[model samples]
Target: MSETRPLLEVSHVSRVIDGKTILDDVSLSLERGDLKVVIGPSGGGKSTLLQCVNFLQVPDSGDVFLDGQSAREMSRRNICEFRQKIGMIFQDFNLFDHLCARDNVAIALQKVKGQKKALARQRAMAELERVGLADKAALYPSQLSGGQKQRVSLARALAMDPMAMLLDEPTSALDPELIGEVLNVIAQLSLSGMTMLMATHQIGFARHLTKEIIFMEAGRVVEAGPPKILEPGGGGRAAEFCAKLAQVTGR
Candidate 1:
């Protein structure tokens, strides 16, 4: 791919379930190393859009390209290869409760990449350290707080050394007091230049973190641009929504 071209290119994307549209003709271009945040109301297709980028949920019609290669044309094996380079974070912190945090992170590297046990554990430890949870590495998810579990989840994703990360409302499930910690870790990732496409309810977080913001509603992108573009009298529903959110959030 040309250096000038975007790292991800999504065009005319749409999804439907039982004839009800979930995503409607959405399109975006993400340059390499860009940090993007998507914001909208609940059930506004933000999660669905991230899934399409991660290749976890295919759109009924549209094109998703990674580094200029069409994801649609890739074989299952190729898709798996593509996915290994892309990390995903979920709102629920879907850790395996039965396993220790370290082991949870190690499983994917060992099973998916066939890494040796010794190496995998080492990698897990490094990732956990990065997320500021090295001391809790041996603790099971059941033993950790919601914020700690989310940190471990992020460590697991970072362990894979992914080219990009897709985060779906990752802080939504945390208690209000605990939310800042997880967001701090993500903020560090952004500063380190980890490409990310995040769906979040935190408009202030979006304004501070993202280079550009994408606004989705019902099933489509109503607007996308730098934060300054969302000023009052911006002339779009997306900007109006953001204005309202800013007022509510008191940002």
Candidate 2:
């Protein structure tokens, strides 16, 4: 890839579900190690946008590019390979109820990456440790707290050695107290230079860590720019929305 090229690009993407347009000609780009935050009200299409970027929900129009390669042009097998290189973290902790934390993280490594059981478990442990969950590795999802379960989810995604991550409100399902723990891990990932595009309602956290914020409304990117665009009196849509959010949350 050329030095000027983006690591990930979503070009003119649109998605329609049951005649309702969920996305409308959305486009964005992420350079290697860049972190971009997508913020909007519920039902504004942030999740669908992220899903399209990862090809989890194929767009009806437009294409996604990774490392200068077009996803729409790739074969079915190639699309699967493309997804493996980009991790998706969901709002719910999607760990297997029957698997312990270690096995939960190791399962994808073994099944998807074709690693041997022992090596997969080894890598799983390292990732669990990275997320500060090594001590809980023996625990099953049923025994873990909401925060721990989310950490296990993070470990599972990290075990894949993803080049970039798309997080869709990863902390949304957690309790207020639990939100911080997961946010802390995400903060660590950002500081470690992980390429991430996150859709979140944590405006304060997003403002502190992200250089750019993309504000979506009614299936369109209404505003996008530096954190300054969200500052008081900045006059951007993002700033106005955030000011209202602050009034409600009292933050």
Candidate 3:
């Protein structure tokens, strides 16, 4: 990896789903230890862009580069390896109903990384503790609150020791009161210097932590700059959009 290159870069990426253009030539980059937030109206390509970056939904055009290596050029085996280093957190906590929180976090370690069961469980516990979920490790997802389940999802991602994380509306599914717990963990990760690209509607929280805000609309990046760009009287599309959002959400 070249020191000068971005830790992650999406170059001219586009995605077409069912004859609709979801992302149109979107480009962005994240440097090591940086946190970038994507904020836009619903159906504005925020989630799709994050999915394309992780190759969960492959881009129809352009490419994603990790550590200066092109994702489109990697072999099948290498792609799997590459994905393991980029953690993903989704709006829905994708936990197995049958598995306890610990097992949910440990499964990938055993299945994908081929670690021994005991060691995986140990690491899973440590990650859970990091996310302040150690007490809930033995609980099933059905027994946990929305915030706890999301924290388990965060613990699962952190267990992988990813170089970068892509989060897509991670708090969207939570109740109004539950949102703060998940956001607290995310803020801690940012403070700890974890590189992240997050798509979220929590404009206030994002403005406080993000190094830059990328505003997208209609499948294109409309504006991107420091958080000040979204401030009152900053005079840009991002500022106008955020002002409207604050009015709607009353936050």
| Error in Å for residue 56 of model 2 | 0.8
| Model 2 per-residue lDDT tens digits across residues 89-169 | 999878899999999999989998999999999999999999999999999999999999989998998889898999999
Winner of 2 and 3 under lDDT: 3
lDDT of 3 by residue, 83-120 (tens): 99999998998888999999999999999999999999
Worst 10 residues of 1 by lDDT: 227-236
Evaluate all candidate structures by whole-model CA lDDT and list the values in order. 0.89, 0.93, 0.94
lDDT string for model 1 (114-229, tens) is 99999999999999999999999989999999999999999999888898889999999999899999999999999998888999888777788787988889998878888766
Give the better candidate number (1 or 2) by TM-score: 2
Ten residues in a row with the worst lDDT in model 3?
A: 1-10
Task: Tell me the TM-score of each prediction against the true structure.
Answer: 0.95, 0.97, 0.98
Clashing pairs in 2: none
Can you tell me which runs of candidate 2 are displaced by over 4 Å? none
Give the poorly placed runs of model 3, Cα more than 4 Å off.
none
True lDDT of residue 106, candidate 1:
99
